[model samples]
Target: MTGAPITADRLASLTTYREVVQQPAVWREAAETLAARSDEVAAFLEPLFALPDLRIVLTGAGTSAFAGEVLAPALARTLRRRVDAVATTDIVSNPREMFAEDVPTLLVSFARSGDSPESVAATQLAASCLTSVHQLVITCNPEGQLAREHSGSNSSLVLLMPSATNDRGFAMTSSFTSMLLSAWLALAPDQDPRLAERLAAAAEQVLGRPDELARLTGRPYDRIVYLGSGSLGGLARESALKLLELTAGKVISYYDTPLGFRHGPKAVLKDGTLAVVYLSNDAYTRRYDHDIVEELRAAIGSENVLAVSAQSDDAESWQIDGVSDVDDAVLTLPFVVIAQLLALRFSIALGRTPDNPFPDGEVNRVVQGVTIHPLQP
Candidate 1:
């Protein structure tokens, strides 16, 4: 059965679809929220940057973790500091390995709910382990424990995104993108004046052509591979999770960088696997992406490979026109929408509810059944 365009009425009936469609508007709101508070954010971060031994750790779980992964490379380049993307789950499990006592660390926590046990525990662990640690909580939920606990701290700053970004769906659609944009705008130097407008326009272009991309999800592919480079590689990881989460694990997925895929991960490719490659704008990186697409097309045929690019001469590529001038870092905003739409369509195609793909209580919006262990002093 071929997928169809999700209409207004249909979108209204599903929380996931509604959140997905409402993303562009929320992104603008998030940008405005950050812009109005840029000076305050700068004030909070500037002093930490002045510290000679400062290290920035971007930490979160699941989609939130991927947000840090997407921003870490670009932020490290902009700040000229050692920036690391670490998952809260990992931090909670191995606090000693992830945190050091000598380095003055900035723990930038990204969380949709901010209430996750790992999120709270990781923040506590950082404070306990590092002698000089500052916390920056970027979360959608203002009332979450992470926000309320650190709101008045001298060493912590909690930046709450627009309230609409507190996603109501099982999967994070608006929440993920809004927080990603908020962090990018908050941290990047010489912020683009036209970023909000360009992001909205680019998102609208993708939103208008859902059917074109939805049809691609209708094929009989049991496995999907998402590939990209640098910041886009983090996006590929998020994209893979979206499909896996929205489909309730019915469709197996894998994500890797274009170069990394050739290093044994490409073995996952099979007869029923569909490969989605996000081509980079960097001249050097684009060559690797293009070569992978060519090689995949030859191996699995064009029907199984989908190439998403801002500028590509390939006839089979999904060219996102008019945004070629945007930097690949910022372009991640619209590029992610393609993955969101595919997950929604694939969920429907598999006879699963996108809003709650796993109604049996196997997985949840906020993770369950996790025990936080006391760190040994």
Candidate 2:
């Protein structure tokens, strides 16, 4: 018998799964909107930046947390802020180490729902224990309790991402990229908003070529590794997680920084492995990213590899032009869309439903069964 049909509503909601073929415009709008607000956010954050000893904490769970992973390095280098991506689960379990005393912290929280137990708890923990803690929440859900935390309080700022990011399906597709873009722009407002414009245009261009991605995803591969440098390193982690989650573990996945991949993780690449590398546009960073790709290509083979980049100049790379002229923050969307589409295509090809890949339900849209504990002084 033929399999059940994927309904139009289901297909529409699948856009929320992060497939590049779906809703690229939503991704673009998010990048543009966040970039346009860079100045306003930077102005609000000037005092925090002025503090020489301030600690910038980026907190979230799953993909939300990965957004921080992508932003931490970029923020550290650009804004000169001491930043770290701490999972809320870790923060709630051990508060002292995550929030050290005498540290003036600006907690940048990324949340899709803003209602997760750990997300709300992390915010409360920061407020209760840290005397000089401030918050800048970037989330898709406007009604999320986390968003309301800043209401009537100048001490907190919440930037609601594009409405579409409040992804209806289980997986966090657009929400992740949109929140990441907001935090990046929040750090670099002086850059041109057109960067975001070009990025959105680029994403649309990539989405136009779903058949190209389909060919890649349709290929037979049992293992996947995503490599990136700087902010894109975190993007690698998120991409790996998406493939693993959506495929229900049929495909093993890994993520690492470009330079860090040579350490001991290179052993995972086999004859049938699909390895993806994120090439940076910056000349300096690109050297490291491209060198690794060249080394890996010679070690493995070109047929089993894919390279995503801002420029198509590299003959072997999937040229995603436009974002190179923009800041890394604005470029994040197109880069992430590539990963999202790969995960979705892989899921469908593997005979798993993209909406609910894990039929046994080991994971859900909002995580469950966690006990909330109050932070103790």
lDDT per model vs. reference: 0.88, 0.79
Candidate 1: residue pairs that collide: none
lDDT of 1: 0.88
Candidate 1 segments whose C-alpha is farther than 4 A from its true place? 1-8
Per-residue lDDT tens digits of candidate 2, residues 117-196?
99999988888778898898888898999998775578888888878778876688878877776677677536565555
Residue 106 deviation, candidate 1, in Å? 1.0
Q: Can you give the TM-score per candidate against the true fold?
A: 0.96, 0.91
TM-score of 2: 0.91
- Least lDDT summed over 10 consecutive residues: which range in candidate 2? 1-10
Per-candidate RMSD, Å:
1.7, 3.1
Q: Residue 32 in candidate 2 has what lDDT? A: 66
Candidate 1 structure quality by residue, lDDT tens digits, 6-39:
4557757888887888888988888888889878
